[model samples]
Target: MKIKDRVIELLSDKYCGLLPIKSIHEEDTIIDIGFDSLRFMEFVVLIEEEYHIEFPDDLLDIQSTTTVREVIERLEKEV
Candidate 1:
């Protein structure tokens, strides 16, 4: 699956079960979906494990308004 799809899956599983995975748009911000600091941290860990990558602490400063597409683009650059 594409990174975006996988992200939606992970988010759906851990955070937002009320929304269907397909309903999530890449342009949507994390805050728009109700991701708090704790959930965002969990998401980062999940993404790291799934992609076998260690995200830099600096990257954790990502704003709640950051889009999924933006996050994916950053991750792709890291890879």
Candidate 2:
């Protein structure tokens, strides 16, 4: 499965509402999602489990500048 698909699956399971996947896939940040702290934590859990790698602390500091592609890039780097 693709990265987007895995993300969508986790979102569905976690009921994370609608992620701005299209915008993120286009190299745009997911700023429109308005994901709060709780949701962002869930996203981090999903990323960790899906990629099987602990995310660096810096990812938590990236605010509206982080995109799905960028996240995937980070995961690939660790994997």
Candidate 3:
């Protein structure tokens, strides 16, 4: 699966009332997926678990991430 799609699945599997898949991808903002602080941290944890890597606290700046691709790229670099 595309990393973006996988990210969505990882999130949707954990929560309800997700935006339509099409709508989620129509924009570049991953946070537009209706994620708050708690869910944002959860996404970080999921990325670490899914990729078998760790996201160091100092490396993660949630404010700068706007899309799943951005998130995956950062995590991929870390992994």
User: In terms of lDDT, which candidate is strongest?
Assistant: 1
Kindly list the per-residue Cα lDDT of model 1 for residues 31-65, writing each as its tens digit: 77667677778888887887889986766865867
Off by over 4 Å in 2: 8-15, 20-24
TM-score of each: 0.77, 0.64, 0.62
**Cα lDDT, all candidates:** 0.72, 0.61, 0.62
Specify the highest-TM-score model's number: 1
Off by over 4 Å in 3: 13-17, 56-59
- Which scores higher on TM-score, 2 or 3? 2
- Evaluate residue 9 in candidate 3 and report its C-alpha lDDT on the 0 to 100 scale: 70
Ten-residue stretch with the least lDDT total in model 3: 13-22
Q: What is the lDDT of residue 16 in candidate 1?
A: 39
Local lDDT at 79 for model 1: 60
Model 2: colliding residue pairs? none
Of 1 and 2, the candidate ahead on TM-score is: 1
Task: Decide which is better by lDDT, 1 or 3.
Answer: 1
Q: Alpha-carbon error at 38 in model 1, in Å? A: 0.6
